[model samples]
Target: MRAYLIAAVLLALAIPVRGQAYMTDSGRAEFDSRVPLHTFTGTSDVLVGRISLPDSTVDFYLDLETLDTGIGKRDKDMKKTLETDTYPFAEFFGKLVSPFDPAGGTQPAVVRGTFTIHGHSQALEVTGTLEPTDDGLRLQAAWELNLDDYEIKPPKLLVMKVDPVQQMRISALLLPESESGT
Candidate 1:
């Protein structure tokens, strides 16, 4: 009788709640840099941190070693040049600056946050569209970043041949806190 009661309680708890949310371990974080001489593309592992949906606060961790751009030598060069040993990770802590009401439909909001890279932090305003999906909240935004701001020097072979401009775009599936159970 005790076991039966325990199972019943668990089933009750498993029932779908209004604010349930879920997170994916395979979340993607990518960045690209295009110059007149060469182009650089890489991906980072999106590590999930604390997330909120109702109030719109979220945090993300990006593993620095996970940067992969197909070429092995370029990846190695980045790690050595950027000094990833000192900064193992980059992070973003942000909140939806505008009110988001998913129940009404697609919520238009700006996620104002600070992105830390290579021990340097920069205030960023990611302007984008956010919508509710069956899995979680999908945030799509394309933002450009300067390597120099984070003290990252663009790799060059001919000394003056490479441009230091880097462009980055990010799309994240932010899971709801209620469903995450954290």
Candidate 2:
């Protein structure tokens, strides 16, 4: 199926590589959603990303099913809202527009890419900070997304309803594929 093929390709992208390639592990991704009465953030540690300096390529993805908002019932509702079965992953692939020196200190970075979720894709440009770490690089980025843009209908029941706009953020320490210890 298409889903399986996409998953395979994403997995391949996360493999170890040589020369100017940085891979992410132990990364975290979060989406903060607000309702009239409350706000909750669904988080996951299975975030995957790769940066190729030679090509200025930046790519990232996370399994939707891996996210947990802390409550079992709410988590179930979220999966249903996201239709994770049909679109199992959220992904971004784009080019880095700003300079990134792995040996340098923290610097502002910009990336332009297409963010895909719920089988919908939209062009986006995100600004973040990239810092050189003892072992590799650390990336901190945040962006706002509207569920309507992805054709995702916000869940609603009784007086509880989720906001259509979500605040998305990610933090990852990217290490050279060789240094990532696979």
* Maximum-TM-score candidate: 2
Q: Which parts of model 2 have CA positions greater than 4 angstroms off?
A: 1-17
Candidate 2 minimal-lDDT segment of 10 residues? 11-20
Give one digit per residue, the lDDT tens place, for model 2 in 54-169: 68899999999999999988888888888999999999999999988777899999999999999999999999998878878899999999999999986677878778999999
Model 2: how far residue 173 lies from native, Å: 0.4
Q: Please give the CA lDDT of all the candidate structures.
A: 0.70, 0.89
Q: What clash pairs does model 2 have?
A: none
lDDT for each residue of candidate 1 in 56-108, tens digit (9 for 90 to 100): 67576777788898999878877887788998777778986887776655766
- TM-score for each model: 0.76, 0.88
Q: Candidate 2: lDDT of 37? A: 80
